[model samples]
Target: MATVRLLTMLPLWWSLCVSSALTPVRLRTLPLWWSLYISNALTPQALLAEWQAARIKSLDVDASRYHAQVLFVDDDNARARMAESCADALAHWADAGWWIYPHSCSLTEDQALIENPRQEAILTSLGFDGTRVTAAGAALAKEDLDAYDLVICADAAVRDAVLALGEESYETSVRLLADFATVADARSRALFDGLDVALAERARSRQDGGELVVEGADAQSDRDGFDALLESTLVLTAALVVFLKDSFDASFTDSFNGLLRTHFYDERHVDARWADAEPALRRHIVTGALDPRERERLFDAHMTGLRQRLSGDGVSS
Candidate 1:
């Protein structure tokens, strides 16, 4: 009887599976309030792809509306590489069911794309079309300027150029990408570093000019679950230390202070999955505080598992 019931449902299950496989995943077209504008040099395709995938997966939302525009300041040889990287990365993500829309613009109308014959040839050999891969040396149209919720300059020069564009109001949102890209060579870290900035800002906005209040712990505690909660808290603390230190240049003391400040600590606003564990987690994080050297050691010990949990695939583009 069990076998007969299973056989009866087999065809229906197969049909449902086929329908799901054939359906296309639709992504958003407009910019979300959490958009990030990046400088041209930092627009590496692999890095952007990893960031895009991680952000959407971890947050459980379609982050397709977040715009990443590349603004070029000079015709430096390196700009060619940036152009190609951004184009390829955006193209790949678009194909992967992301509504990615990347635009490239120049600081000045007189300047065209970077002119490096050797680099152009190399880029072409690497499957980049010379014509399509070049940065467009044109002023940003009004629509482009309005698309992003925040603008991130990769360096001082990019910041200066953006200021010269006469978007004074947007200046409040302009931040140096370096401030977010603290990790020396890890692009995925840089990406999440930026997300930390965006999320913090978003949380602050929800306060309406006041600090968010965290509710007190419940009266009764689960003694049986205490051991499991403690273990999870330690792991999370280590992962956060790694993120802040490697990606934001935060010192041990500053990292702990910032972690405590994040809205995620607020029991009232935190996700339901973390509600019961937050108070214990906070206590554990505080108790395990260490110096920079010890912090690095803890990070190294748990970095692999942390990334796997936060990013699903551990930062692979």
Candidate 2:
């Protein structure tokens, strides 16, 4: 009887071993659980393997990303499509990211990519899992510009427009984006249009305020700033997607090395080129302020904080 019982247990052990290998699991967590079972053998090892796999899978689905919002300033329907494609490809991931495309970011109403079935399907396939899809652009209440680490522009037209908007107009644009939050009507398209109008007005203000002032030689600077803001914004926004997908776990930092590069800050791009000439452009950002001196001081404080951080990173002074 004793010999027969021992022999039967051999099959039970073999079954457990096979099950552990067959189940889908993360590469890292598998070993620890496998070892526990291999050593303890008190409970089923396969169950432990399954649990670890589930935990890791959850990380991919949720992570807190910063500045995942992207503002794509486009000009026409074709441009919107192109921008959407690029935004989808860049933003679509395990953790959904945003590419806030405002129709008014373009030149006219028809310029927006409002309806595209195939593109939507493609984005869906990529897991564009964003919870909200607002047609209105982001309304950042209060110039609260410092809250965002990056701002991306799809075109030079966008930068010119942003600079053109007056302070009140810019504030209204952000409000319009907020309006989308409450839009529960069939006329979502119309509500979205209202938001576009706000953005268009803001762009016009940026230009009229002399914020977008330029000459023959400095024309490239405007383009550079626009591009830089976009790339930096994409990177920042994508980082947020990555972070949120991982549920804000600091250990999920494996993605940074692949993207943290100089191409984003290089003058070959719009951001880099514009940053190189910030002294001249700085005035434009504070154009509507009551006290330019105080604003400049505040801006300086912000710059100091950024510069100190950059210096610590071994970046060139």
Candidate 3:
């Protein structure tokens, strides 16, 4: 009696499996059957082409709605936080002009916010809502790369980390934030030039060969060195913001590609390429203790100077 019952249930199970495989709606819910069906129905090449088409369509829709969607990645949360604060400072542009959405993440596995007392104090003084700034604990997901119009890395190492997680196709979208500094603009060029000199001097002192090496606070382990690093990151964040605003203003009607160009530092020459500039640049940055109004005033003054220089109207000292 038990054997007969088992035979009867086997036929029913077989029928159900066949039915599930043939039903389109059921296939959508069943991963195993869906994979088999897709494998039998389409070639791998054809499937990839379909996926590419869908991605392009989604990006087109996103572009139509916003001027640009950007993702900023860094080793620590400081750069990410600074990027958010800088974006807030430029919020007025979102009214009728370009709408920029900035997202941030760290390369570390732990998502817990790292403590940066100085950076936190500076941002707090700037009048930005602290609640709005939070960094992701882990690196960005590979599949989520398509969501951003651009993935701007804080430096070459950050860029490399991002690229390693993403496909080769994502290379075009990933770029060094420093690359957008607009070297043609005098103010921006001066900032980067000072950084290069500082980094070069430090690099030369440590090595005998005429090879250029770049070291950070990790190498010097001094309070002033660390402060210089923080100040440089802040300045770069501001400079990139200025560059982005100018790009959008000049190409208000252009496509995302038209508004931005693809630029990266050569792999062999990546050392100290985006490291912080000298402390002199910090004069333009608001960091020390100050009232909110004063902080805002100083921030505005720095941005105004950057804008003027980029626009061909030299800023008067």
* Strongest candidate by lDDT: 3
Supply candidate 2's per-residue lDDT for 110.
56
Writing each residue's lDDT as its tens digit, candidate 3 over 3-75 gives: 0011121235654654555566755676886668665655433333343344322322233443577777777
Q: Candidate 1 regions off by >4 Å?
A: 1-87, 90-99, 129-131, 141-143, 148-154, 172-180, 183-317
* lDDT of candidates 1 onward, in order: 0.35, 0.33, 0.47
The prediction achieving the highest TM-score against the true structure is: 3
**Which pairs of residues collide in candidate 1?**
none
Question: In what order do the candidates fall by lDDT, top score first?
Answer: 3, 1, 2
Per residue, candidate 1 scores C-alpha lDDT tens digits across 1-317 of: 00001112124665465345333331123243322332221234333334433432232111222223333222232332333243333234223112223334444444444344544444354444456555344544445445653343334555566766756665554443323212212322222222234432432232223221111111124322322221222222222223322322233345544543453323233222333534544564432435445544443434433444445644431
- List CA RMSD, all candidates: 26.6, 23.9, 22.5
Query: Which window of ten consecutive residues has the lowest lDDT sum in model 3?
Result: 1-10
Q: Over 4 Å off in model 2, which ranges?
A: 1-69, 77-110, 130-149, 166-317
Tens digit of per-residue lDDT, candidate 2, span 181-242: 11212222221222224432443333233122111111133444433222222232333233
Over all chains combined, what TM-score does candidate 3 have?
0.44
Deviation of model 3 at 71, angstroms: 1.1
